[model samples]
Target: MRTSSGAGELLVELHRDNGVPLHQQLESAIRTRIRAGLLRPETVMPSTRALAQDLGLSRGVIVEAYQQLVAEGYLISRGGGYTLVADIAVVSPTAAAKPGAGPPRIDFRYSRPDVSQFPRAAWLRSVRRVLNETPNRSLAYLDGRGTIELRTALSDYLNRVRGTAARPENMMICNGFAQGSRLILQVLAAQGHTRLAVEDPSDNDLREVAAAAGLETVGIPVLNSGIDVDALERSGADVVLVTAAHQFPTGAVTSADTRAALVAWAGQGNRLVIEDDYDAEYRYDREPVGAMQGLAPDRVAYAGTASKTLAPGLRLGWLILPSWLVEPMSQAKLMDDRGSPVLDQLAFADFVAHGEFDRHLRRMRPRYRELRDTLVERLAARVPELEPVGVSAGLHVLTWLPADLSEEALREAALARGLGVYGLKPYWVSGDGPAGLVFGYGSLSRQEVVEGIDLLAEVVAALRS
Candidate 1:
């Protein structure tokens, strides 16, 4: 319960005589103070220089202590010479921080799914069946690479549904994409590969996770034509992470020609390709698009999760590894964690084997299609100038707002109206392009969509005038 995150009003003395490093000891002492409820969350910490001067220690020592806490999600740095205790105070602490309050409205945030139709009965039935049939080996710590049932089912599911040509041995289950990413990065770092390129307009906070492992993000502009291949060539990244099925924030599918070109480029340069097959199953217009990982499994690393498909609460996902990288990835995965929960894995496998999985997907498809169409239509009518991103094969729509209305003003205006929307500016590290909103319709109702967007439209109109 002791967390080293607080700004003390009293001049605390440091004990440098302990066997533990002075800074680490100091960090632990502060953490104890925090858990005891003596220090408050969001309390500002003294500058590293000031703390160092007071303790008669080097500034690097205090800075290192602060950085370690920050990496562990205990403290937050607001820059401009300020560090503060992280948000929320709790009696007990663990790695899993409690989730934010009950669901959100107009929650255009990503990684969402239609929870109303999450196949509750089907899942419970599967769990019951698994409990009945699971043997002694199933209960023990078997292969971290997942059970044969889920892998075989996934092999068929991916090939038949998601256009993934994977064999049973090629797939392994993990907690989710976040773990999968770290595993892949660990392998790449082990191979001395560091500089990597990703979509310019990409997720903001994750870049730091890569950076911590000594990987630098080389940005590539995301055009309506998928990634700008020319820009990618110019950037000269050692590896590339792309969302080919339906690109996040832009929803642009990697065109077939571009897919071939990317494969060829990777083969020629022997570079790694990280394919995030996110939200590939929720397309509305037509059948789901083919996964890029199938084009050259040897070069492409495929990652998918049940977060969007089932629900974010289900921390279950699978990665299909190529023949060459499979062993290394498995080793890295083992190093990270022994494996996912056997109970959930067995239950999911049972669900897939019984055809309940496919039935659930079929049932949810129409509802998602209707919701996607509703959101797109409402966006068009309310904000005529804003264009929704193409190839609707995902959970959310990325609508481009006109340059006349700045994202900064519009976000402020929308929040004032009790509506939530995030701007695309934070995603772009290369200083490229206009801002837009990533609108998620998964957890919202038809009425809420119309009303929230109407609020956004009003904000735009005000900014334009």
Candidate 2:
């Protein structure tokens, strides 16, 4: 409850003339802050005498307040008259149950990553190195294609890790995936490419992104084997954006044969494919699949980002274009923010070249896998009838709901119980399918995942009743 006076001290305001005792008022204030997470666990607090003097209260008042908090398990009396927040302070069940009522809800949205695992020290080292090593001229506005150092580093990393045949000249770094997709859509629309085909149960926001560029987006069916190549052909779209390595919301790996068929389809019609290699790192079932761009680099455009691996706020993403589209995409990027920031690009380059990026991913893979396993196990124990599909690779899994339960109803019921459950309907372009839920395990701890599922199971039971 109490924080150190030096820098970590909790600031509390008191009204002496109020009817409430000073000790009780102080105790309530500290308890509230502790539950709110403003005063984190294990934070050292000022000495009782020091605090009493600061608040213009008697030393006895501070001592009584501290004793009460200690008894309640909010603060602990350390040796030498020091008081600290308990490492595992017990928040009331009702307080912990509903997330929005107390702390922030444990969000299960699929687009997130556990940013708490981001390598701060490694990133700082890279940033420091970039500051020291980068030439002065490199800071100025340069080619819209991005810095040669970063493009080269990305080219090598993508080729080695994702099996993409990326060349520095073809790489264009833009602000995150949103901007990357926008730039590509703009270029395609300029080339008289009017129709775009996307996976049926893919990101709905993409339809708006395509519309901005005057291209119409049509939904192509997505099966267990990945996007239905036959359905894609029938759609007759000029360009297709696919998450081949691991499809979003479904985690369906595009099969080898289907990948070849897609390549052929693009070749025959002079169509273009954009390989959105999002969250390709955290695969657990087997060695992660390589990028589909390698199959036909000339027919496909490869896109990757630091959002999943690093943090989304960094606003960093890159696209490797084919020879025909490189200039156009580069020009499109030039018009969009005059290219991504150079400092971040350089730091990321350092992070990659020095092998810290690989090290960070190595550390995160097992943690994310453990979280995914915990979610599956808890849901199975509670709602055995609910089987989670696509538990293979990505941060999320899809589970088909019983015929009676609508995705919307289940989501609302779960939210009422303080669980942030998401439905697959919004992602569906046509909103066609059995009602299903998408559970994103990233951005949540293993404990939170289990607790959320337990609440979700209860919600489902109530819905069934």
Candidate 3:
């Protein structure tokens, strides 16, 4: 059938001798196009007369097909008899599974804070204060380094709290760690740095980002203390990305000697270190360790985010660059989204300057500590076969399962019982490791943790039997 010139070129095929009616063929074709996303939502359809003339079909057939589609909710009939595609959800043909699948009842997913504890009243006050005091010019396009008020506030806060040597002029406020890491990797790649070394069992996102930036990634083994520096030196990588303060998925803090050796390694070849200091706010046992960036400010680029401290919804993060790399990174930031939202940055600045941020953290630290304790205690009492790894810091506890147990089987069994648990295998670059699971207690209550662990014990016993 010929395409109609009207309504953005409506094309349809009809079968007459094949025994299927012309109207039925038209309706099925249109429905298939809409379902396949070839016809977008709200797309106008050709009038019956025009389509019929183009296809050499009777007007009655076109009218019948249009009416049937409208009755089936695939098309919307509007004023003046115009038909438009309905704005219904489109299921992609390539999708592995359908969307809207509900999450498990008891989820132990990590990297999220207790959003219910967000200081709504305090944050509102800060935003309202910023709106009243900020000048009209402050709302316009700002420097890619972000608002000066926030940089100054963060410079002071990071220094005092994390013992970082950050300066207001050398920091860039980003959407979150996701953006900050990308910006840094892009800059490094542009500067002719080719190889990036990452922790063997670290977050897989790092490897993906490095590859996106056109750099080769090498996985360096992580010892109990931290990343294996000796292996890192032999890898010939010019830069390394590490979560030194608290390693992710396996929660091991870098020892002081290893930190020094890492700095020395960078110094020998003028290498750089990208430190992801996420979730350093909550330390249950004692005072948190000072940041490695503090030791070698010139060699380390430090990144911190509000995802773990405040809420992931905030999408707020900051990067403290070495003086030499500031200009390039600032230019990259300008090209990347023209800097983060200004009003949110100003509000966070006010939050920090007024000590509201500290007060909020003070209230959350103990609460998270209690949840971590409960998770560890219940797991120990019920499923003593699973051993808890990592220190008493951050939002998650990495647990090593019994050597005989299969991580994938346990995860599937737990999911079948309406409980969600994450396995540690996917985090490895090689995907060959021991059977382990990560237990995130951030968003869970004390009772949820107890119940989840008890259910996990049942699953483990059944698997063994």
Candidate 4:
């Protein structure tokens, strides 16, 4: 258990007592510190040597703990000799879906669902109803679009809850957001629009996915309010993708004025607006923000998913394209997966039609809000220098760490203590202020939230002192 010079002094509270296993306890402690907003994202973690020495444990134990987090996507490997709190939110819509066996670990990186609380019984019940009620032969390549029943239900629900527009015919049910996005790219490219204007700080993986599909993405500067319209226009890209509901890391809801500006641009210029309504549900402060698609259905393409609301494993998402893009995008989708799995689509339709889905959301939205509140209060108490962005809505909160505390040093300290935090640089095109760390409360229980944030504060103290 050799230590890293002066870094050996960093402290980690390892409770061998109490019934919990050391590995889980360590993981819990790390999670607590991260949520409390002490460890900024992208901060490098200490070597296992330093962690084992400081915690008075075998290096093997520290190594195993670190490996667990890395497997869970909370920690990333850097080149020379270090581990880091990797940006967990880098999602590529292009990546093929891989199967996960069971519940996801508390990843605090992506906007995910609470696995422990998912209404399995209700979903099963819906599955049973759909299985028995629907024709057996209907399951084979019936609608390239989503089930008519589901589309009808979504038409009313999305309009009521998210302010999405139009007749059920306007909505084309596809796979998840990634699949849907790919189809849209194909449609725009087919129409001879090869360039897309994307948010500078938007998902890197998503941009890369578009690029893979033969569309050149032009980066558009995103201000605290919304995308820089002037910069976007100058980019000369005819297509655009926006995570409007709660801007990814920054969590700024597209202002009403900005929404209007986007609407005007798409309306007058014939530009296509691909609206990734990221987390439109889960609003604690007030009414959930409305969708940009509703503002100009003819120009805006509305995409929503059950990934955040239900779970990503369901592989269920929807896209409502404008009239012009509909035929082309739908044609592209037919050639893609030919449409998502009929079984899952039918099950989801039953879930929504029977009102079981809404009930689930109603129950979980408040729980998520409470978790968010706990994270904010705890972070403020622990690290006064760290300021949080996007506390009002969304699953994660971004913390701006003090510039004096090197992100590298803080990350090392947090890793020594088994902490996880995502740095903001990954979200930027090109800019440097202080580091931005993302804290996701959706997957964590209220108790985990408290403990995670507290540990983070302790790590911050060790780094600076």
lDDT of 2 by residue, 1-465 (tens): 434654225588788788888899999998998886777788887787778777777899989999999998999897888788876644655674655464337667777898987899999999999999888999999888999999999999999999999999989888988998998898889888989999989988889999989999999989888899998888879899999988887878999988998899899866999989988987888777889888899999988988888889989999989999888887777777787889999999999999998999999889989998998999889987778988878788888887878888887877777678888888888877667888888899988998888888788789889
- The pairs that clash in candidate 3 are none
Question: Which ten residues in a row are the worst by lDDT in model 1?
Answer: 1-10
Off by over 4 Å in 3: 1-101
Angstrom error of the Cα, residue 172, model 3: value is 0.7
Candidate 2 to truth, TM: 0.78
TM-score of 1: 0.76
Worst 10 residues of 3 by lDDT: 1-10
lDDT of every model, 2 decimals: 0.79, 0.86, 0.90, 0.76
For lDDT, candidate 2 versus 4, the one ahead is 2
Model 2 lDDT at residue 120: 92
What tens-digit string does per-residue lDDT give for candidate 4 at 46-74? 87887777777788887788788888777
Clashes of 1: 2
The residue ranges of model 1 lying beyond 4 angstroms of the native Cα positions read: 1-105
lDDT of 3 by residue, 335-373 (tens): 999989999999999999999999999999989989999
Order of models, best TM-score first: 3, 2, 1, 4
Question: What TM-score goes with each of the models?
Answer: 0.76, 0.78, 0.80, 0.75
